[model samples]
Target: MYYNILRGGINLKKENITFLDVLTLFIGCFLMSLSLNMFFNPHSVAPGGITGFAIIVNSMTGIPLWVINLTLNIPLFILAYKILSKKDCVKTILGIIFLTLTLKYTIGLSEIHVTDDVLLASISGSILMGVGLGFIFRINGTTGGTDLLGLILNRFFPSLSVPILMGSADCIVVILSGIVTKEIEIGLYSAISLYIIVKISDIIIEGFNNSKSFTIISDKYKEISSSILEELDRGATILKGEGVYTGNKKNVLLVIVSRRQVVTLKKLVKEIDPNCFIIITSINEALGNGFKSIE
Candidate 1:
């Protein structure tokens, strides 16, 4: 998916965007606005980023959220235009315009809510916003806000992760919301909403088939490899390695499997060679012949 986006970006200078791209952008922004008006804003739960900032401003000054959102994003748009690619800037502008419009028109949507459960509202609202964000990101567009600021800051500080920087910025807003409202639970709920948004956005962008990667070192490498291929119906790759402690050559096995299969694979490996060294880690995405298709 990323490779295709990069390829499309190269040709994006021609400014030829498909109807589907525009449709996706509009849908994403609309959902974001709906979630804000109906769930987050009504409940005073700030989910962080530009949206959170807008929520805070609205709460304090009695201004409409759409107005605050647009007012704050204008400078960010200028910054994006200067720092990001033209294609990116165009998409961001489209997102901002549609998002603000949706927020303006959907002002009364929150009044019709049936549930007052803050937990339910926070989680559901976060999911909606996250999916909206995922769509924008999938199309190589960003909703102009702290996300764009994080990108620009990354240029000056190459070693810092953008998500961390953005997360920290968001926490500050959440904390301020607590201080201003004098309700500690609101801040705690906001933090929960923020976490849900990040997680859901990752799942949308990375795909839903969560998997784990395992690296194994053992004397019975061949048997373990065969068991994984034949018994578990999973592929295994043998990597050549040199053990520095004993100066011995060894074969390391690498395998990928679903989260549920981790226990079964671990048992199989232990049965084959109890002394085997194993390392397991979760992977966000895996695309190829055995897993998801690239397309």
Candidate 2:
């Protein structure tokens, strides 16, 4: 059971999981372990996950992080197995095993600190966590922590997005870890690290090709539209709009452009019609000719 690909935001069918996927999962697990053993664990900073909880437990009970991580994930994997596809289950279990093994082998790395400052440690560790988990999520592979828990809970609560659920779950762990360890700054730093991790992972998954959409209202719609088409080599849509207050007929020009072209577009519009009303808004994603293709 392997996820061939996702379509319309869901895994629709099964296909062979490629070797590249396996290699990517391994690398993701490795980086996560490195962040834990080399950065988070050394500073006693739990950055919010089952791994975070395990770190706190290790600090308190003198237990190996690997044991705690594996123990906590097994039940989660079992719960996730019932709802998820076989492919997801396989990859998730592999993620758990790889992480546990890496945690065991890389425990010695804790003796080496990349930074003595807690703030620096938190930043560096969070960066690795983000990149690692980003790779894992890009492949749609789960490591059976709150990641799995979020998926399972999504069945019960369909309105909330998985990321929100995962973040909420991790937040609870962060708070509890702070309470148990009696360290307020640990929680504060962990919260910061968690934010960076979420941001970086989102960047990796959604990509950096962010775009903007513009709605332009002006008397010189024709000139603005032409300039946009000729100067930007992009398409524009002409829309008929009536101003409610004035009830006057007006032409609205709609344009979409990449982030890099935002300044150029502003200049183009300003030069053409300084009095033109322009509404610019951020676009999370745009598909079709000038952007990402529908999969």
Candidate 3:
């Protein structure tokens, strides 16, 4: 039904919001609230950011996490409206509202008691929270707090990355939480949780359909290209390159292939050019004629 609201369904180039995006935001926010209520809050594990700060405050004041989160974000929402695009700000507001509602209603649905083993709680909570955050990020929605701060700072420091900025802001909260609580272990565990959260979020946002890219530098460029095209059925791009050491001009072959095809491509390249220089690296996502089609 929400898909009908958009002129171009699943075509992200359009400026309007789609129903799928709203659904994703709802799920993402719900998962975030679930992770906070079920895992992080009960165990007193503050993994950083707004939710983490709320946990710290709730522990001390005995206030509900949802209330603390909303109260803290009111000012940030104003700042976000000024700094971020209207669409982004609106989506963030929705995410915050959904998260607050979910926290209020579903906090007591299921309780996880890994408090005895703080490490287990930290790790497990990090995963649940990270996955939720990953989904939110994938859909281009944020739950305000450090996200908005990161955006505001990014405008001033264009060279700095937003994730790094946000992570740094979260770290400050975590470190201060540790200081305030007078527990070094809490900070350390929070750091571990934060690391896991970032990693899991990255995997979720980028997806697991990872691929390898190969850059081949060889004199037998023609043969390598032909083998890749005819045998592997993969496209190869030949780029003109010059060697700095020898001042020799050569053609560099660039090919992107699935992880399973890495060995085969290596063998094929070796067969044609034994003395060729080949560099292979992992790529997040590859979209093209033979790979995943982008909509």
Relative to the true structure, how large is the alpha-carbon lDDT of every model?
0.85, 0.86, 0.83
In angstroms, give how far residue 66 of model 1 lies from its true place: 1.6
Report the C-alpha lDDT of model 3 over 37-58, residue by residue, as the tens digit. 8777876778999989998998
Ranking by TM-score: 3, 2, 1
Per residue, candidate 2 scores C-alpha lDDT tens digits across 24-46 of: 99999999999999888887888
lDDT of 1 by residue, 150-224 (tens): 877777888998887787789998897787778999899899998898888778888888799999999899999
Better of 1 and 2 by lDDT: 2
The regions of model 3 sitting more than 4 angstroms off are 1-15, 109-115, 152-165
Clash pairs, model 3 backbone: none
Model with the higher TM-score, candidate 2 or 3: 3
- Candidate 2: the clashing residue pairs are none
| Number of backbone-clashing residue pairs for each candidate, in the order shown | 0, 0, 0
lDDT of 1 at 154: 78
Cα distance off (Å), candidate 2, residue 88:
2.4
TM-score of each: 0.84, 0.86, 0.89
Better of 2 and 3 by lDDT: 2
Question: Least lDDT summed over 10 consecutive residues: which range in candidate 2?
Answer: 4-13
How much is the lDDT of residue 176 in candidate 3?
Answer: 69
